[model samples]
Target: MNTHNLIVGISGASGALYGIRLLEACRDLGVQTHLVISKAGEMTLHHETGLAVSDVRALATKSYKIADIGAAIASGSFRNAGMVIAPCSIRSMSEIATGVTSNLMTRAADVALKERRRLVLMVRESPLHSGHLATMKTLSDLGAIIAPPVPAFYTHPTSLDDMVNHTVGRTLDLLAIENNLAERWDGLKNARTRSQENDGGRD
Candidate 1:
């Protein structure tokens, strides 16, 4: 498959692992990633994931300083398949919602929205307040997808990796990237049918 250019942003969320997983997945798929990490994200990367900034940067094909507004991805002319803000923080979401391109992360997202490209925000906050909801609504109206890193229990996940993979898989699905990170409901249809058959036979 031809490599597609993807813009990935890491914000100051508790789950930095999602961004790391996304980077690894993109690298494995031969996708070129333009990565940016917010200042808060840099601290969180070390605090939460215990990964050095340089180590994290090594995962992506290209890295850019978040404050660098002159980055290629900050312009609409630079073509990209899409942009994803994995573990997107509420602060970052507000920035994107308000068109504040102070950093490359938000600037890339702004370019994606203006260029009519897929802009997926994997917001990672729990028990959100009204302000957060309002920001999400604003972004939704601006054609940005506000997806949270909610886990899917229907897959009967047995490990932390399973949960993370499921969420990341759904994010990729939204971006139209085909991947089998977790089993779908279709795979359980036959098992459900067989269980029903056994119950009926016992009755």
Candidate 2:
């Protein structure tokens, strides 16, 4: 109900954990989340995370059926912060790119774009063709952010959870969602300079 509301869309991408962790982070911040998972997203959740549909639903402040295109998030008048499609599939990306709102997931993304709100797409695909690159460009031109869950190793992540957390945390940063989920790189370059001075420019 507050302006801090975030609409989350989980598509059929492989990294279902990203979406799950994003919801957990939102709960940690006490930000209300509206979750909508595609049918394939449900299958991926069960396959990869072993989370039942209800389990995923329980992570959010509210859940919506994928086909519920008339949901509040589908309208620009919903007055929310923004939307993020974690583990967004190429199929769903195309739908949002073309303004084809076949379901609530893409419909909400459409609303985010039309209202000039932040729409972060955590696209989860690899070996992309030129078409994929071009669609992402089109979305960027339309003010949608193509934020794939790429891991940052400068923080020296120890595990998969660290990677996911850092990626999710960065995506939240794009929306100005306050969090300390990942270790920030603070003055590392300056520290390296001091270390070089101590070492006399030698190994």
Candidate 3:
């Protein structure tokens, strides 16, 4: 497997920053990223980040059109580390779960599953219904990871960037890509010790 190559898919989900930051992180880590963004994802990117689709595409090592089902990344033999659907929309999640891919983004994801490669779906939905939960379970049973982009408060994130970085860092960890984007958790004792040390001079 080509561990340096990763497939990044952006669906029509609200947290476009996750996908963008993932791309940037991969770039910094020297990982070659093959990116595909859905039409709806493009709109969400502009609406949420004011970044044109082209700007986001520039961050990736390579970019593909959502309709290009014949793209290299869509093939099982593409030999990438795996695929990640950042901010995966419920629609795309359901499509992949059903094995009825309608576009290159979903198609590449299906390829990853069939190839028995790591497939991470950052499903971004609120108040998921039973049907959605069942769909996620189905994907999990098939060896696909349903990693929603939930933030970790243990990192004491002070900004949106910190939260996003933490999520992206964990996602990268799933692919065995080592990175310092996430703040490692120390033991409770260490945490308390730090707190006490800081309090010694305060009061």
Give the best candidate by lDDT: 3
Pick out the ten consecutive residues of candidate 3 with the lowest summed lDDT: 194-203
RMSD of each: 3.1, 3.4, 1.6
Residue-level lDDT tens digits of model 2 in 1-203? 23389999999999999999999999888899999999999999899988898998999999999998888888999978899999999999999999977899999999899999999999999999999999999999999999988899776677998999999889889899888886677798876775678779886
Per-residue lDDT of candidate 3, residues 122-163 (tens digit): 999999999999999999999999999999987567899899
Error of 3 at 59 (Å): 0.3
State TM-scores per candidate: 0.91, 0.92, 0.95
> Which ranges in model 2 have alpha carbons more than 4 Å from their true place?
1-3, 190-203
lDDT of 1: 0.88
Query: What local lDDT score does residue 151 receive in model 1, on the 0 to 100 scale?
Result: 89
lDDT against the true structure, each candidate: 0.88, 0.91, 0.92
Q: How much does candidate 1 score in TM-score? A: 0.91
What's the best-to-worst order under TM-score? 3, 2, 1
Better of 2 and 3 by TM-score: 3
Over the stretch 1-203, how does candidate 1's per-residue lDDT look in tens digits? 22789899999988899999999888887888999999999999999878899999999999999889998999999988899999899988888888866789998998899999999999998898999999999999999999898888876677999999988888888888777775667767775775578679452
lDDT at position 171, candidate 3: 95
How far is 94's C-alpha from truth in model 3 (Å)? 0.6
